[model samples]
Target: MKDAIEVQLIDTNIYKSKELWQPYRARGAFGGQSLHAYFLLAGNVDRPIIYTVERMRDGKSYATRMVKASQRGKTIFVCNCSFSTLEEGITLSHQVTMPTVANPESLPSDLDIFQKILRSTKSESKQFLLRAEKNINDNSLIDYRAVNQYSNEEIITGNVKTDAHGRRWFKTRGALNDDMKLHACIIAYASDSGLINVAATANGLSYNSESMGMMASLDHTMWFHAPARADDWLLYDIHSPRTNHGRGVAFGKIYSSDGTLVVTTAQEGIVRLTEAEQKKRRKQLEFENGFLGNCRCQL
Candidate 1:
């Protein structure tokens, strides 16, 4: 029996454009997988590698999203993300500070840990593990490692809150073909693993808990501040900045173990408490239900 991690590509009409998207059933869009896709495409053209996204400057413009793709040290592709906003005076700026803990070299790979658990848990999971291993055994585009191992007995629960965020170290495992965007796209694909769960931890919620409802990412934005080398280990440190009314916001920093910040990301996800579980909790809170304000949630 062979273990496999399904990488099925969805062929919905909305996603037929391979030029802009790659359907990932378990994950999401493969092209939108990472900020690296945009960087790789832009980097291929001889231009400045840094792509900046400026949000809401004046009433005339709501947000300005700019992408500059470069290659051979020159500029190639530049795109502007546009939006409309009404005229109003509002200024706000705040971001979570990066956390310092075990460096990338100090951690294990996510795939190795996943395999260990698969073999230990269910026969089906084990078979899938074998298949996944075969799939990646030859291709060395990206490497993955899980921070803490998950199991049936222990069954880590809730969106946990800790001083150190969940950490993963990934890099290109093989040589590149000179098309930097391909590697970037691969990194985009790899970035989806376990990141959203890290945000759930903010509410003391873990995916293992049945009480936890479905969580899905609604939107993602990333800015490539500097060039990234997938061949080298890059540390992804993610944190949840806010969670209210069944929605959570997470932000992350992609850094070299040495402190070079190469990328930054912002993601909003819909987090909902299951109806059965919510009703169960509601009964227990009937006496003090008014305190939490109707227990309304929007995810």
Candidate 2:
């Protein structure tokens, strides 16, 4: 997680990314590492990203900042963030009940699943696995274990069942310092892990599927409701409520092991089928229309 979010201060209210991390076959850097900001745009991985922070507002209890990320003088992303001081005492508080799920210890790490698939005898499967392996960090700082397991074949074929909802247990691989802000940043990074994919999975599309043409986040918002440790096991419960046209939206909640609702997140992104898939759908529609026309004439 440290490597994923490392940044160097260049000037007052300006920071530059020390390194950029892009997902397998992604057009731009990962969105989560840009912590506490919205991804208004995306750029390729060919250059370093510079972040400029604008102090929008400052008050005794509330503050706001606007962040713009750019590459080669072109703005690639912009986000508006607001912060609030912790209240001395809670006046009112309520959260929806956290769903019961299997413990993290009972599930296999995602890397373990990837390695098991790498031993497959099928050549096509092996090739796909090789490419998919790039998505996993070699020396990962975070541990992820999916609650609902799926094989690499199922994922590649877009046959894995998500029902528009998914759950995973995640945490930093090692203990982190007792900095609440740092922990929040770590959670921010992890939040983008597979959020937009939840929307695609609702339409039976996976990032690994040839039918999936594009999947990229357009905007992300996070609300920190309470303090939580990133090193402790946390449950990320996510669901996609809608996907229409070329966009999909998903909502997620992060809960501590003891069921404390720590954060809420929302994201929307581009989700589209490949041209081949679109063409196939068109042909099928034409065939159905022709068959129906003949039946009507006979009637």
Candidate 3:
């Protein structure tokens, strides 16, 4: 039982970014909005989170919830969500076509993309790469394919621009048990993955931001317009409207393969770019380059 409990917590941390309870999934149980996940600046991973949910409002067609998450008696995150039943109100025609990209079947796995980035890092980062690779192999629950090709080479050169806008296809690696709530929760989990990266990328910052200091989710909100299956390929199209004063705001829309809009999400994150970490990585990279240069001449 202890082992199972630990595994469940790990699973929750990996998928939902919340280790205590399933918040967004619970939101889908009422059926509408999402969550903004928190990353502890204290660098504590797997810290037990305590979550409490309160019913804010209940209406015929709309419902609201307030969730608070804490660690060590310190409030880490809080979210207020409102859900509404689909109304037959004014419908708008699709004006934006899904940007065509290389198909999921044709693209590299998400694991491969991460492995490339890991390998590009310094030897001290090898352990992180190894751990990440293991995690990807063992628990790759989400399948991902990007509209733009990702290049690890460019990361080393600091010229990587996967795309002007962030676009990707994501679905459960395997089928779910026909639970729509579960699917929505999975999408909520996936939404947290790169919302800020879109912002950073748009603003000429690397996803890792070699000049990085810190970045974290401030708030997350979403609205569901129609039902969707997380097990089927759904496109996540994300873009950043503006970023300044150490904050970046991003918006996303999810569409089923058939072009039906399913969900929309909004998030704002606090991003502080610093030169300290940048200087550290640059020196390490320089050492690696010098070492490689010698190896080549000697051979």
Candidate 4:
């Protein structure tokens, strides 16, 4: 006899596109699968997001939902997630070795990193910088620290060596109540931050660069491997294997500070820049520096 595994498909649809607006569904998937678990398990909840149930199926102890999400009027994300009634079975699994890294407290927080970056980028608009500074200093629900020690000046100057691997440690800013769904959603949102940057850093690009005017996530996928608290420091180990055609793909493995492998994620993003844009941006930076250089100088 073989160990039993159940699978189900609920419903499906094929949508058509119009010439006026961009077609949906065919483009990308949505976020909020863990929250969907809340909606399903709790059975009485309300959310602003619009979910069109693509499929719903249930077995004796498991249920699954394929959800398409939209906001305002656009299909933003989609996912196929399953939940199960707890059952006991033989359990055996293996995880890759967790990398040795510095303590989260010893590393720099996102606020620290942003402030350092702002110091080096004083040539940018003062209004924009003030807004960014305020956003970082504002009380927040998440705390993040970079495992690698690299300064903003070194990066923006393109004088630092880019590491192929990166790690981040994060936990909730405040204590979170014991809710599995809430914890999962928080982690999902946070996962999007570093993966794209890993690729950009390797290419010696910063999000602040004018040459890279636009960047957007094309698709994202996360798999919950084991239960972990979002409010506890979680280490996200990331690597980017490929970047081409204005796009880059990154893969990540998330481990709890205790060494439990909690989740895995992959995302591909569109990072577009043309040679003309680079040339134009270089001239702009040069002119701005020259103009500011002659103005009553202070450092």
The lDDT values for all models are 0.52, 0.81, 0.64, 0.64
Ten residues in sequence with the least summed lDDT for candidate 2 = 31-40
> Residue-wise lDDT of candidate 4 within 82-195, one digit each (tens)?
766656797778999889999898887877776767766663456446545664655544687888666555444433456657789988777777877667767876777767
Candidate 3 residue lDDT tens string, 1-299: 11111222333322123332222112111116544444332323445545566787899988877766555676656667677776777977553566666677777776776676666656344534554465455544567777766455544433465443788888876767776766776777677767777777775665444464666676677777778888888888998888888788889888888888888888887766777855776899999999999999999
Against the true structure, whose TM-score is highest?
A: 2
Worst ten-residue run, lDDT, model 1?
A: 1-10
lDDT of 2: 0.81
State candidate 2's TM-score: 0.90
Q: Residue 211 deviation, candidate 1, in Å?
A: 2.5
Candidate 4 has a TM-score of 0.70
Predicted candidate 1 versus true structure: per-residue lDDT over 142-192, tens digit per residue: 576545544433332333443225666777656555554454545544565
lDDT string for model 2 (1-299, tens) is 66567788999989988777665555678752123455656666667789899999898988888889998898888888888876787578899988999999999897777666666635365546666577454556679998877766675576566679989999998998898878888888788888888898887777777778898888888888888899999999999999999899999999999999989999998898889999998999999999999999999
- Top candidate on lDDT is 2
Give lDDT: candidate 4, residue 122.
67
| Residue 19 accuracy (lDDT) in model 3 | 31
Candidate 2: deviation at residue 137, Å?
Answer: 6.4
The segments of candidate 3 whose C-alpha lies over 4 angstroms from its true place after superposition are: 1-48, 86-96, 114-138, 156-158, 162-164, 277-299
lDDT of 3 at 255: 87
Residue 27 C-alpha lDDT in model 2: 67
Span of ten consecutive residues with least summed lDDT in model 3? 22-31
Q: List candidate 4 stretches off by more than 4 Å.
A: 1-48, 85-87, 116-139, 155-160, 278-299
